[model samples]
Target: MPDGNGTFVKDFFIVGFPGLHSTYYFLVSAVLCLVYIFILIANGMFLFMFATNKCLHKPMYFIYINLVLSDVLFSTSTLPKIIARYLFQDGTISFSACFFQMYLVHYFGAVSSYTLAIMAIDRYIAVCYPFGYHAIMSNRNTLILSIVIWVFSHPISIMMVVRAFPLPYCGTNTIIHCYCDHVSITRLACTDRAPYSFPAFVFAMVILLGSLAIIVFSYSFIIFAVLQISSTHGRLKTFSTCSSQLIIIALFFLPRCFNYLAANVGITFNANLQIVIILLYSLLPPMINPLLYSLKTEEVKKILISKLKKHQVHLTVLS
Candidate 1:
């Protein structure tokens, strides 16, 4: 499937959305398209609701905005290519184009991981040291910290693309997944990938497990603090904030652990299994993040309700 260029080539492949009746590609495509449409509209509405509504502007929601933005990037980076491949029988991407694809997908992924870690620390401070939270997480400090995470994620992702692309390709350049994933693409590399894979593995461990450890430690103390509170009401309020964060962190961290660990060890290459994990990775976390955050916060709910009522009124007047 490689194109005419001797150095690098990837012209076309039959990938994305398999295991339906041939008659159902059209139906399947329609369903996937609808899913994608809702993802954009719903996530976009959350982003808009957060940005314009001053009431929702706090350290938590500010972090949520970053999360939403990353999710939007995360969803778009792979899904469009996926939809394209299904709609058109063949799809082509140049070497450099593949590199950029790798960068965007992983870059935003790392961004999301880093942001979740930040959110965990934010909650830790809020719950553990309620009085000191505001002073510690000033607007300026949070802004600088966000910038640093993005800056840090870039070099690592770039290295991944640089390391993976130079390897020799024999015949078909088709990547099994819709997007060019770091590990899957590396497997195809003609050269040994220890130099690239090792560093990436280390980074993954630091970001995934390391973050999990911090979150666990923070929450352990948080649980202790909650138990000490005599009033049931106070404890419930505290748990609500921690609950949504816990859900998001677990979803993001677990698959990463599975992917890195499973691949490092010699595992069976069940194509169906791989596709399921990849789809869960690509789709689930981003889709659920906005839903979880919006559901957890009453402020967000009120704003959404108000917006809905106003829109309904407008429609009625027009009619």
Candidate 2:
């Protein structure tokens, strides 16, 4: 359906996995629904703790709140439609709606990347410059940095959408991925997408590599500082503190770097395999972040344990 401007304004169908059979739609939807529920519950609990517990209001946790919000919002933007796509066999998304999702998907991704970088910086300061960490990563300064991250991520994502949205989409309206993104949607454009895609590819690489470089730089110093510890126990303890973050960094960045590079460098993957890779990198971090990053911390654990004991006491009285 073309509006008065003669541009085609039509809904696009999201083909989740080209190789997935309709018979397994219900099963897949159920599994995704469970994952979505878990993400909400886990992240939601951490958010609640952050809100109520003043002890968790350090610069590090302040930065983590952004990651939590980004994760939940990203999952919200993507999961429902795909869940419906599988559960009800309805994958149609209006043109405007699809582009909106594309913006959010990319925006949140960039936010998470930068947030991780910022977290690495926080750890670097804590480990390498413990005396000055408080002054440098103050509550106000951390808040400002988080604000910068949220605001700074917008332009490239908005430009990606702005550039790709106006292109003529005709004939084939099926998107071969779980969600609407610059690459998946722009590939549907009726004109030459090379010019548009090249810039987007560049932007994606810049975001990924730029943040990765920061993490690596920060951690290199952190590793050096940790190794300088006089005692083996001190070194082990310091390394333990950073191990969770290292795991998350690996999960979030490594796979995505591979996917992007693979797509551009003529490395081919089966459609289902590619989609699986995307979902793993995009979805897994948000789901596991609370457990690996926040809950594992001693402060958070002590808080959770004290609260649980209080709850148990209340239950006993009620009984």
Candidate 3:
């Protein structure tokens, strides 16, 4: 059936929000541009600081640098083309390019999930096993963990994309979402998508849920450890440190869970609303992570402040 339906789709039209009114495309495009700009600024700042500041090179920040890389790649994979699609009316993407985008879209996303879980594990060790934290999460081991996450998470996404790539996509060439992805691409194929779709969905769920489980498990122990602290001061301080991560986790996971439910359960949801949900979960995390994760750390905050002050002083002298 690969060629039974007709010519194989050589390219795909990224039909972002097909239901959206044409007149409002400008407004939507502007908003997307703003979010895209913020994502670049926030994540870029972290990467610059991490690379320039020798003191920032530690196990924790190593994991963060990895997240920054993934976020940059993730945003790059989707945003630039979508921006052009909106601003220039150039929505057509080559078939192979679309699949490659699908690979990176899923790969970096899974890497972020796994990287976050690694962060949670890092926090758990720091909180629960304070004495051995340094030895357990040594710089070398942390580097290895980050490398393993980048290396291994890729193949899982490859499996999902490979299954869909060979299927005959002879039907509609319009992708409903902003970018190429497993579900949107596979659903358009001529073949019975169940063979391809079901496994991919399950695999996606397993990655989502498994990483979330690890985070939850780590936090559970962290919470238990926090309770045993003797002073209210200690308890509040410990909990405060974790609050930002909890917010990031909720922002990233909750909307995604809802999107999955809406997709699979035959629930009638507005198409624009679905796109908005997708944007919220993916875009907000990277934009805010620099603040919530990096700046939240006292050491990083101090370093950033010192750097900013120095820059301001130099600017004043120049003026």
Candidate 4:
């Protein structure tokens, strides 16, 4: 029987890992709790630094701030409930809440994809047209672009959720993966899901490959520009500037592309293996990004050292 809201199933169960032994639940939950804590402390520190430090207000940092926000919000939306599930053996989520989580998962994902593309653009301009880089990628323009990325990411994500949410999910109410997402939720639809699934797949590919194409194109130009530089040191310096972004990009995008492609194609993965891969790509980047920025970017590194020195002095004075 359908509820007043027309959902046949009023809630869904999020099974973190179907095969896990009961004895190890506490261990798994504790590890996840630590990861969540690290993500917050790392990203929150970067956010605080950016907010207080005006010298950090450049186009690249502006784009990074957007990425940081998306990373934090995404982690927040997904981590708590899953942690609770393992900690308390409670995996239940209400109908509306499940869909809301799905929306946020996709929304932040889309934002991250676009932000990475914008990051590539920032680097492309910096490397290829050094003289005009500042003029082209001014703070105001970068902020506007960040706003546009956030605004534009909503439509398709909302449509994916809206299209999938109203479907008849009268079958099993257990979501197989760690978090609520479109595919996991829609798999339970009572009706044939081909029509719905295909469109969602297309939208996902467009977001992933579209942004990926931009990154690829921009880096192609950057490579050409770097090669033309006469001095090895000049080329090395330029490449070093991009190394962190490239590392983050590879971590975030490559595994995701492989997973999406593998699923759509005939290749199959073990259920646990698939879930682990998803977690690797989804969670690792956010945890690693702050460290990458602090270590790789010279300005950020210098400022961080300065702040640490000041803190040390304050501690010494207090003692």
10 residues in a row with least lDDT, candidate 1: 3-12
Error of 3 at 14 (Å): 0.5
Error of 3 at 50 (Å): 1.0
**Local accuracy by lDDT, each model:** 0.76, 0.92, 0.86, 0.91
RMSD of candidate 1 to the truth, in angstroms, is: 2.6
lDDT of 4 by residue, 64-95 (tens): 99999999999999999999999998889999
Off by over 4 Å in 2: 1-9
**Candidates arranged by TM-score, highest first:** 4, 2, 3, 1
Candidates, ranked, lDDT:
2, 4, 3, 1
Where does candidate 1 stray beyond 4 Å? 2-14, 17-22, 311-319
lDDT of 1: 0.76
Better of 2 and 4 by lDDT: 2
Relative to the true structure, candidate 2 reaches a TM of 0.95
Off by over 4 Å in 3: 1-5, 315-319
Q: What is the lDDT of residue 30 in candidate 3?
A: 88
Candidate 3, residues 109-153: lDDT per residue as tens digits?
A: 889889889989999999999899999999999999999999989
Most lDDT-accurate candidate: 2
TM-score of each model, paired residue for residue: 0.90, 0.95, 0.94, 0.96
